[model samples]
Target: MDRTILKSQLERYRTPYEEESAFIDSFIDLTSDPLAYKRERLEGHFTASAWIVNRRRTHTLLTLHRKLGRWLQLGGHADGDENLIEVAMKEAKEESGLTSLDLVDSTIFDLDKHIIPERPHVPEHYHFDVRYILEADINEPLHISDESISLAWITFDSVVDMIGYNPSILRMLEKTSKSEILL
Candidate 1:
């Protein structure tokens, strides 16, 4: 698909919480099919991101993925439902416990392809579509879950300074800082 068409198609789900039942279909279309990526839809590994920005500051939050050992925005695979926005919303709520966020109609980033290092049951070469949703109303205190070793909402510049951030994470920060996608 042309980049413009692909982005326009993705922008259709501005309010995922509204038309939620069709999320899976959109996921297949947006991703060119779900299973072609990482884990199952229910497991949500096609790389749709759900994010919450500090309503007052616009700074985005991130989780320190325990297993992945990278500072990343909150997101996962489609799980069973493929609504990309729902995937983003669900992942954001589940990862950060902030229920008041609103999903931006546009993406903050579209890193549609990348590989994961090998893990226990999962294989390497796990490709991801990686869409980013900007958030509003991010003042809620976070309640950490097993997916993260720790979590913090920081300025993109600050996150770039972390010691463990890999090249990909830093690249993401750079893109976000440049406002290449959303804000």
Candidate 2:
């Protein structure tokens, strides 16, 4: 969970998206602050999420985020855990109610920096999200958590149409596609 280790991982990651590559650089710069993982730090905080695909790799699990009301991947604040892979798995299991999940790859599948609108007592800030891929049986029952309004498994072809696609998500999808071929 060391920032140095995370920084090394980010530095080694190669992506076609220049913005994401820049984000990695920015994230590396922020690692100098030891408190980067704290939600209250305000400058920005590390968030982790799962790009969960089914065993068949035909569909991905998405949640209708309760607060944002948007179809998005399952994840949340790092909450002091610097091991982003663990954070992603923990959030995915908690939000999706899936007991069995296997990491598709130990390396990061995607990275995104997005503005989180101010809510209640919290001011506006950025979320430097590190995304990992996980796989589960498509037939597994999903018990939606209070964090989400609903959960659905969206096919790869329909993702963009369903969620008004974000480029980051598309990048993750493309990365997963390539990984699938390698596997």
Candidate 3:
């Protein structure tokens, strides 16, 4: 998979949180591996997500993940695709049925490494997730894909109450709140 674009983006990303310095560094290093973006790598693989917000930036979309049974941002495995921005856009459209999505920024918005529990055939592995901020018209109708049980636009203030203190979610929210575009 081509990684130059991903490497360039990662190199340009600067985390706001001091504690995330290591995570960013580690993610950059992961890009060095030729197979790092492949799902078959096992150790971990790249996944892209959309932190989809409404035109007003007041509400962010969340999907009730079918497999994980949790309300989380819309995303999926790279499946050998190297361009994560494209992956994120495709996933957002596929998962949410919103075709008018617009990328708020092309750079990485957040990076997270989380473990995927072992399934019957798929062994436990880590997902090195890359998140991007995207905007869409909230008035557009939403069609739930098979990947999600339901999809909803959750207000920023109510996300924590719904997800219960997930650090990644909080960090994304904090970033969004502080973003100049929202000012």
Candidate 4:
């Protein structure tokens, strides 16, 4: 994602503890695996998420996630906040550092509720994610962030060609793109 814009935007904040906590809590809860712990129902501690789709050049802006290692859209937990559309905007700004953006006229692509698998080291965590899909236009350039190792503007159709080391994010991208959930 981007950096210069985020750095400028975050310069006024003294500490990011509160924001980080909310985001991390939501993320851990969503990606944790509940079934492995014999829990049939997720606590639903973190059910909210928002992702932005950027139409860039002949393709859409996608992130090559650092941890998840896949070419995917920009998204993160809601931090328990219901203003998911704003959350999508915030994540798009912070992660990609792009300032020229607006939520698509129609939230053109939503997806099925899905479970985020827990990592091997943290199997008890699980997230029942209610994902919202949004789109944006990149009027300027893109900035990258540590959260992702790389970034690209990829076509909606070329996603399947880029294999993901971790299939979870890949599945998410596929499902979100294939479904007609946006309204």
Candidate 5:
């Protein structure tokens, strides 16, 4: 994995939240460690996620994540992929089963660092998730992968009231709501 790309993106990325900004710095610090992109790095590892929206950008696609059991954005482990954009795109397609998806921009859309609870086999760790904006046809069919219990296109207006609301997701929601290109 090319750490330069990740470092470059982090240098250019900006966030209103001080917490996210701290995450950005920590992500940049990870660039020095070659193992940072690998899931084997039990301390923490890179993840890629898609803030998927419809063509109109009125709603966002979320999955009832099977492992985490929460309605969250489409994404997964980077698994040593340096091309974070491709990672995000692949996760979106695999999770949503949407063949046609367009990346709104190559630039970073959001950054989040969240703890993953320890599972039976997997130990607790942090996922330094890098997110990007993606657009798909709302009319297109969606198939739920085994990773999710269900998939739904939740309106941007109603995401706040939804059950299993995540603060990190809400941060992305705030960013999406303010982005002129998104709305």
Candidate 6:
């Protein structure tokens, strides 16, 4: 897991969103350390999340984050892992209890920067989340982990309505809508 690899991947991502482009530039300009994922690094750590869709592509899995108490995608701190894709998949599997997930696309699907409020010992900081899309079976039995209060597979049309309107989720929905696997 090298910072150079992450930098190259971000550079290769093509998106119409100007904000994400800016985020990429900022991420590259900020630091060259692979340990930038650590919270102690402080400038803004790399986080990874998965926009997980079922094989039919009609539904997506979301978790009611226990700590955050919000309906959000499955993911967590990169925790020193420079391979964001692997981090995303690991979080997805850990949170959703889905053992069989296939990468829908190897390319980065979305980018977001959000503030995480201070909680107890953890200080408030920014999370530079790199998102990826994964495909799994909707019919598979899901086991909810302690990390989430609940987990549900929401229909594509009902996502924003169910989870609350989130720009990143909307962006991912738009991207997946145009993907051949989803079609």
Predicted model with the maximum lDDT:
3
> Once model 2 is optimally superposed onto the true structure by TM-score, how far is the C-alpha of residue 44 displaced, in angstroms?
0.8
Query: What's the C-alpha lDDT at position 55 in model 6?
Result: 84
- List model 6 lDDT by residue over 1-183, tens digit each: 467777887778778877667677767754476558787866578899999998878988999999989889999998888888999999999998898899887777888888888889888888989888899988889999999999999999999898787777887888888867556
Q: Alpha-carbon error at 11 in model 6, in Å?
A: 1.4
* Candidate 3 weakest ten by summed lDDT: 16-25
lDDT of 4 by residue, 1-183 (tens): 122222232233232223222333343333333321123444433333345555532345778778776666676665544444565667777778777665553231333233455766544444434345555665567789888887776665676676434344454465455545432
**CA lDDT for candidate 4:** 0.50
**Winner by lDDT between candidate 6 and candidate 5:** 5
Q: Please list the C-alpha lDDT of all candidates, in the order they appear.
A: 0.60, 0.88, 0.89, 0.50, 0.87, 0.84
lDDT of 5 by residue, 54-133 (tens): 88768999988998878899999888888889999999999989987999988889989889999887899999898999
All-Cα superposition RMSD per candidate = 8.1, 1.3, 1.4, 12.8, 1.4, 1.6
lDDT of 2 by residue, 1-183 (tens): 677788888879887788788778888877777888889789789999999998888999999999988989999998898889999999999999998789877877888999989999999999999998899888989999999999999999999998896888888777777775426
Clashes of each: 13, 0, 0, 10, 0, 0
Please list all clashing residue pairs in model 5, or write none if there are none. Answer: none
- Between candidates 2 and 4, name the one with more favorable TM-score: 2
Tell how far residue 125 is off in model 5, in angstroms.
0.5
Model 3, range 1-28, lDDT digits (tens) per residue?
2588888788888886765556777788
Predicted structure 1, TM vs. truth: 0.68
* Candidate 2 residue spans exceeding 4 A from truth: 180-182
**In model 5, which runs have C-alpha deviations exceeding 4 angstroms?**
none
Model 3 misplacement above 4 A: none
Worst 10 residues of 4 by lDDT: 1-10
- The better-scoring model by TM-score among 2 and 6 is 2
